[model samples]
Each structure stands twice: as structure tokens, then as C-alpha cells.
Target: MPEDPGLPAGWQADSVDGDAPAEVERLTELLRAHERAARGWASGSEEDVLVEVHGLETRENVVVRDDTGTIRAWGSVHDRAEGRMLYVHIVDRTLADDVATRCSDVLFAWAEAQARQVGAERGLEVQQIDTGAFADDERQHAWLERAGFTCVRTWWQMSRSVEPEEVELVAYPEAWSRDGVEFRLVRREAGGLPDEADLRAVHEVLEGAFTDHFNSAEETFQEFIHRLREDPGHRWDHWWLALVDGEPAGALVGTVSESSQGPDGSYVSYLGVLDTARGRGVAKGLLHTIIADAAARGRDRVGLEVDADSPTGADGLYTAMGWGTKYVTESWHREVPVS
Candidate 1:
């Protein structure tokens, strides 16, 4: 038997960045290729993915290779959600065929180990790890089952093409508004980065709004801010906040989808409204701001993900506002005990 039976026979795994510059560049290329195969879109330039790799706070990244030393997979357990939840992103192109059984086995073991480590450090009895599979990817679904991840949620990747003429008419019903609610663009510091205080306020609003969300967890200030900054398309001017009676009541962070749609379009990275702000026009107002900005900026469309089963019926709102699901993805999760 191999020293690590979870790995394919004669295959080996190593840290993603344990070597020289050339190796890092090669791994980045591998990552790009793997991502394109998995998601139908290339991840980013080498520099872009490297920035993301370095920004991860508590992560274990690995590259797997066969005996001939050709890299076949990349996997990571990224603790961006502060140990309450870990994200497992793995892509395999091993000769083991469409199943990728060995890669799934090894990657999942690594993720569970990291989950346990972080949960113990945080004094928690359990922590959950999440991973995604395309809704129609049966091979990946089977692999996830073998790794013990239960299919937890389905999400829609929704997008709406926009024209300048319709931006002003996009619906934010006047009746949904309480008096004195308004949307404001986030301002930045001298370097054109979001002012630190404003960024923190956005994070705080998101943390509060998602308290009742499925599998929710608070991403730390540092993690939340830096992880978003790592995106090559990120920009301060794209962020916004909503105010009700001059108090911060909602927040939305939008990023240019340069990798997929270029500067001609943007994605709503996040949208949240305070508990007290719910049932008001805050969420819709924030989304309206995004579409209007896209129109004003000459962008083609705005895109976002919505929980398929959101209690608030967010999907209904998106569809009513002209967004349609371009594709669907599923989240699979497993909880690991600290002990």
C-alpha cells in the first residue's frame, strides 16, 4: 500500500508554493487550466490567482502529480469564513478518468483535517466545510458523496443584460419604501481604496444581515476586506451603502467581472440589509444602484447569485427585476468534529 492510501497509487502531493518562482508560475497555469475545465471559464492571469493565494488567511493548498511528475490537480482548504466554515476548492484532471476518486478522497481528508484544527483552535465542537459542483456534473456529485458531503443548497447564477434606457425604469417600488431611505455610493481614501472605516461598516452590515442565512458565518474584518481586494476586478467605486434615516441600513459590494465579462459588466459580490432594515426598499435599492451604475458606466449587464430556496424569496425579486438564471450550482457540505 502507498504511504498515503488516499492518494492514487504512485501519485504524490505537495504544497502549492513550496518552490521557486518558476514553479509558482507553472502551478498558476495548472490552476487556470483546471478552473477552466471545471467552471467553463478561466480563473484569471497568473498574477491574479497568486494574489488570491497569498490573501487566504488560513489555507492549505496542494498540487498533485503523477509518477511522471505532470501536475494533475490543485486543491485547497481556505478558512476565509473564520473556521466556522471552510471552503474546499479542488479540480482534478488525473488520468483516473472522469471520476477523480483518488483526488476527491485526498482533498476531502485534507479539508476535514483543517476544519478540525481550526475548530479546536476556536473552541468549537464542530466546523463545516463546503464545496461546489455544477448542477449537472454527475461524476463530481458522486465524488462528493463518497467524500461524505451532503448536497445542502442549490444556487442560481443570474444575470440581466441592461440598456441605458431601462436603467431609470428598473423597479424599486415606491410603495416598498419607508420615508427617509436612501442609497449612497461608498467613498474611498486618497489611494482610491475603500476607506478602512467604510469597509468595516460594510462587513458589519453583511454579518448582521446574514445571521439567519443558511450555513451562515461571519467572515472576519481582515479576511472579508482583503479577500475581496484580491480580486483583480475589485474597485472601491463599485461599493455602496443604503441609509434609512441617516443610519447605515444596507450594503452591497460590486466587482467588475473582468475575467468573464470584462469591464463591460460587473457582478454583485454581496448584498445585505440590516434586520431592522428588512421589508424596506434597502435590498432592491442597492441592486438598482448596481444596475444604474452599470448603465451609466456603459456596462452591458449585472450578475449575481441567489439562493434557490431563500426564505426572503430573493430569486423572485431578481426575476421580477429582469434577471434570469444562466446556470446553477450546488453546495455540498460536511461537518467535522473538533475531537
Candidate 2:
């Protein structure tokens, strides 16, 4: 049984059953409201909420409801990798400040206990709580600071407008070359599934490419594949590979984006070029391919996130490729010792 997070009188912590329609709807609305407050716009749907909370075996979720049975706060923890856990903290922005702070405290306490539980299950002595906030979200920053999390990094959320003419402007044939580097989509077999060898190559290239990036942690190949597959928009054809001298050297994994107010878009979930192939236009080729593919599919934009402090000047590269900053966010982390 999960431990209870002692809350103020008449408030109680309970587990979230992702299969319940009412539960899903309530959570979705809470998340969207939180985003709307932080960013002036929101993008998540009920489908996104389902993808997040459905994997009960790999995730822990808690919700606080008042005596009136109204949910006012939620906390979810994902055992993302061997040593890392991801946290989602949401409280009703409409509540009074003191009441909201108390609710936030209860959620954070629940999260810490859940973190230790997951850490022990994974046979680790310490676990990291990774969470994010919009750049201008001062309330969230205050909550995180009071909970002992440190602001570690900043990111630029960027997007590029795609036009049908880009399909002619950017060459994305099955096989294309630039500066002695070759780019191609990961091949699919008769079963409509990606080739295992190509999948492994893409994973290896990405694992190597991000080795020196901020907070880099080792994620097993199985974990990588499983996590990516959990996304509702995942598609086999969105995976691309780059080669130099016919050897795997870079990769870009994309996903379809669903929008209620506008045309759907494409998102660059992962993009990396191995150090050995960095200067040969491998990254540029992969970017152009995704933009061209999005245009061909009538997607209006392509979106991605980048480290604000990247030493490689990656944001500059995105800007040069016609991508502009849509918004900014920050990473907040807290390390907890497992009992």
C-alpha cells in the first residue's frame, strides 16, 4: 500500500486510476489550466494525459481531494531510468495562496516518498527528481524553491513554419547527401515495423551525441525504446538516420503534433550528430529532412527544444535554419536519498 501524505483537515491523498473517465477529465483540465496560467496558452489534451498516467507499473500518481471530493492537487512520478525519476506537480491556481501552498507541500511530500520507493525498487541509493517550469512562472519557482529543488538549466522552445514550397526547397529523397554525409529514413520491413539494426544504430548515435550535455544520464536501450513508444504520436517513419562513409553517425526522431486550433505539426523529439560527424552537415541534413517531410504532410510547423547554455551554439543553428523561439522553460532538480 502507498503511504498517505498527511494533508490539512478534510483533505486526503489518493491514487489516480488512469482508466476512469472522470479522473482523466479532471486531471486534463487541471493541467491545461496550469499551462494557461504559466504561458498564456496551453497545448495538452486528454490523450496526452492518458499517455502520461496510463503506465501504472512504471509510474506513481497521487491526487488530493477535499472533503467535498473535489481534486485540488496532483503529483506524478515516473521511474524514467535506472537512476532518474521525473515529477509533475500541479495545484489549483484558483485556490487561496496559503491553501495552495499547503496542498503543494502535501504533493511534494508524497513525491519524495514515491521517489524513495521507486529508487529502492530499482536498487539505487539515491534518486533524482527532475521537473520543469515555464520561464516566467514565479509561483512555481517559489514552490520548487521551498521544496528544496535547485534551478539547474534553461531551454528555448523553438518552432519553424513549414510551407509546401519547402518540399521543393529541401531535398529529402529516400537517400540524400550533403558534404559527404548521407541521410535516410530508418527502413521499414514488410511488417511495417522499423528494422532492429537501424533502431539500435539511432539509439547509439543519440546516446553518444548527448553524452556531454547537461545532466546526461545513461538510459538503457530498452528503456529508450519503451519510453519513446509510449508517446501517442510516435510513428515508425519519423525516425531518421545519418551516415558518413556508409557508417551510422547521426539520428533525428520526430513525432506528429496534434493541435485543436490549427493544423497539426511535426516535433523534433531528438536530434543528434556524433562528434566525429559534426562538421559535415549531418545535423543540417536531418533538420531539412524533417521540415520537408512536415511540409509534404501538410504540417504547418516543426517544433523542438534546445539547451539555452549549449556550448555548440545549437540555438543559433536552429535560428539559422529558420526556427524561432516560441517560449522558454527551466529545469529544476532535487536529489533524494533512498531509504
Q: Across residues 61-150, which tens digit of lDDT does each residue of candidate 1 receive?
A: 766777777666666666667545646455555455643677666666667777898888888887878778878777778778887889
Clashes of each: 0, 0
Lowest-lDDT window of 10 residues in candidate 2?
Answer: 1-10
- Taking the tens digit of each residue's C-alpha lDDT, what string does model 2 give over 1-339? 234455667788888878889999999999999999999998878987887789676777888898888889989888888778999999998999988998899888888888888889889899999999999999999999999999999999999999988886556645688777888999998898899999999999999999999988888889899889988889988999999999999999999998888899999999999899878888888898998888898889999999999999998889998999999999999999998
Poorly placed runs, candidate 2 (over 4 Å): 1-6
Residue 209 displacement (Å), model 1: 1.2
- Best candidate (score: lDDT): 2
How many residue pairs clash in model 2? 0
The lDDT values for all models are: 0.75, 0.89
> Against the hidden true structure, what lDDT does model 2 obtain?
0.89
Error of 2 at 208 (Å): 0.7
Residue 87 accuracy (lDDT) in model 2: 91
